[model samples]
Target: MNDPIRGTARGSAPAPLSVLDTALAGRGVSAADALSGSIALAELAERRGFTRYWVTEHHSMPGVSSSSPAVLLARLTAHTTRLRLGAGGVMLPNHPPLIVAEQYGLLQALAPDRIDLGLGRAPGTNQATAAALRRGRSDDDFPQQVVELLRFLDDDFPEEHPYRERVYAVPGPGQDKENGLPQTTGRPSVWLLGSSGYSAQLAARLGLPFAFAAHFSPDHVAGALRLYRDRFTPSAVLTEPYALASFAVMAADDEHEALRQTRSYAHSMMRMLHGKSYLVPTADEAASYPYTASEQLVLDRWTNTVLHGTPDRVTVHLDRLHEAARPDEIMIASVGHTPQALLRSTELIADAYTLPSTPVPVSAR
Candidate 1:
């Protein structure tokens, strides 16, 4: 089949996917301001021919402030004309299914064809924080919640079923009789997000698309895809596995700049490990972090999968990733010590991957 990604000859190619994330310019800017900035950036990505602009959800975060993805997505959706807008993921364990349905349905109502919801099981924070957000819900029951959410979105429960009689998503877009679920006047599309085997298999069994969080999960990238593809049994939505791999793409004018910029992520990762994940700092501020020797080594290891270097250099690695994973789409997450640095990374990545004269016509979004 022809790979929609590049319109090129295909022996084992996946279709081109939409690109970019909503947390475009990292840094401690307020969510409102960041959204405003990202709106312009998304416009740039669209004009540059990138695919999607996915915002992520994180709560009680100081450095990063992407708390309400649905609300932010709606705002960003209003600003951009085309680049598909979505959530890199909303943590399922944190919110009720109906709430998710209602919020996204509202967004879908506003931006019909351009809404997407990628769900992850992680709290995106510490246990205490997750506990606070979840009230009394069981994180152990995430799988069940995922299923329930899917059924709600599909609104596929037959009326004859007793459960269907007493239970229904009041705010569900309604079922598209054809889909046996609530009818969608065209709200957000759903995607399962993962970092390992469990999510991959779940996505397969559910017959929904999957997005792997390769940004901080380089080691499991190939393995997760392997499970996803191996266990996949075609379903109604997809005949084969449709995998999207997210990565930290930090491209700059030079290797040194890229490496230095990556310190932001390293620091953030450290904070996460210790319960203080914050938005990336300014380059000047980042230089001031007193990382211990051991901490530096850990981050270096964690940064293994991150693509850092000039566009040409980064493209070489990206091509290798494509060869190995053959993802339908590649979502680039360029978080740097400063907003300007992050914007530069995104620009350079766009340049490296979007060249009309590049010899390799690979376009995995």
Candidate 2:
């Protein structure tokens, strides 16, 4: 069998659950300094041997300040000696092609092999925020935007390319590795992110890596994964069905502490969804809050999708999920009030859920 996704990656496997710390700024840190510290988290992930460090983009988000992934990633590259630093997703619908191309291109220049450019078609915000980002695009323009972005980043466009003059990923492609480090081959690896069958179909058809947003969109995980694998075709980006499944995780020495942390997250989510004081409360503060039936309902919905509890407890569910999805990599998303707590979670997962020492037999292997 011709292996699928061969030479695609060193850490792209399903067993080890990779950790993704999005909304790092939401840990109640000052926006200005939070990004720097978030980069520190990325460094820690590398030290802990995580697969990657991805920051998300969101405009006008109170709890998070990662509104510009390119900018933050640049800062991160300067601080982190290792770790593949990239966007958990740069929402394609929110921006135009050249802007993203040039920005991430610059990032690749700074840290070549250590980059990935995952794109999500979702606005990642409400309609109000979407309108604020760009007022002209229609619903159909979303996929076009993604196609345009890939064309720009891959540097495959010709001089006659319609957007070439207006677009450039400057100081192009000189990034290289000195030691056993990761380097972008000028253009970063691209992945399609989604929570629905639509994205699944798109990823499969394009033969690109697929990452399901099961961290928050658990309701559709199994279905979406099925669609992605079933409809998969071989393309330049990928030769067969390769996936990176994600789920929220919280680990601690004790199960009670894990649940306590989840309660805080649930409470904060309620504040975000409803009109309430919005803050990413500490576990202590969350444990103190009085959750209502409304909040409980919200918690239940997320719990179905989120992987919570101690490593032992969480692994059982994650293992079941891995068997079902058979992802190339599994990313665990987490955030906490203190950076120490966040780092601890990263270390815990790395120690407990990493892939087997010997590589599994990949389709392309």
For candidate 2, lDDT tens digit of each residue in 1-365?
A: 11222222233234544556654545456776566567656766655556677887776656677788888888777766545777879888777777777787778778867778888877766667778887866447767777877876765566787755554455443222323345344577788888888889988888888888887777678888888989999987666677877888777778777776666666666776875544567777776767788887885665445567777677777778878766667787765555555666666666565532332223211
**Which residue pairs collide in model 2, if any?**
3-363, 3-364, 4-363, 4-364, 13-328, 18-332, 112-183, 112-184, 113-183, 113-184
lDDT of each: 0.69, 0.68
Q: What is the per-residue lDDT of model 1 for residues 1-365, given as tens digits with 9 covering 90 to 100? A: 11211212121223343454545335656656666566656656565556677777776666565677777777766566555777878898899987787777677667766677888888977788888998988668877887777777656667685647455554454534534755656545678898889899988888778889888787688989888888887876567778888887789999888877777676667667765655566555667878788777766775665788887887777778877887877777876655556667777766666522122122312
Using all chains and alpha carbons, the TM-scores for the candidates as numbered come to 0.85, 0.83
The true-versus-predicted C-alpha distance at residue 64 of model 2, in Å, is 1.7
**Candidate 1 Cα misplacement greater than 4 A, ranges:** 1-17, 20-28, 160-184, 277-279, 355-365
Model 2 weakest lDDT span, ten residues long: 1-10
> Which predicted model would earn the best TM-score?
1
Tell me how candidate 2 scores on lDDT.
0.68
Error of 2 at 258 (Å): 1.2
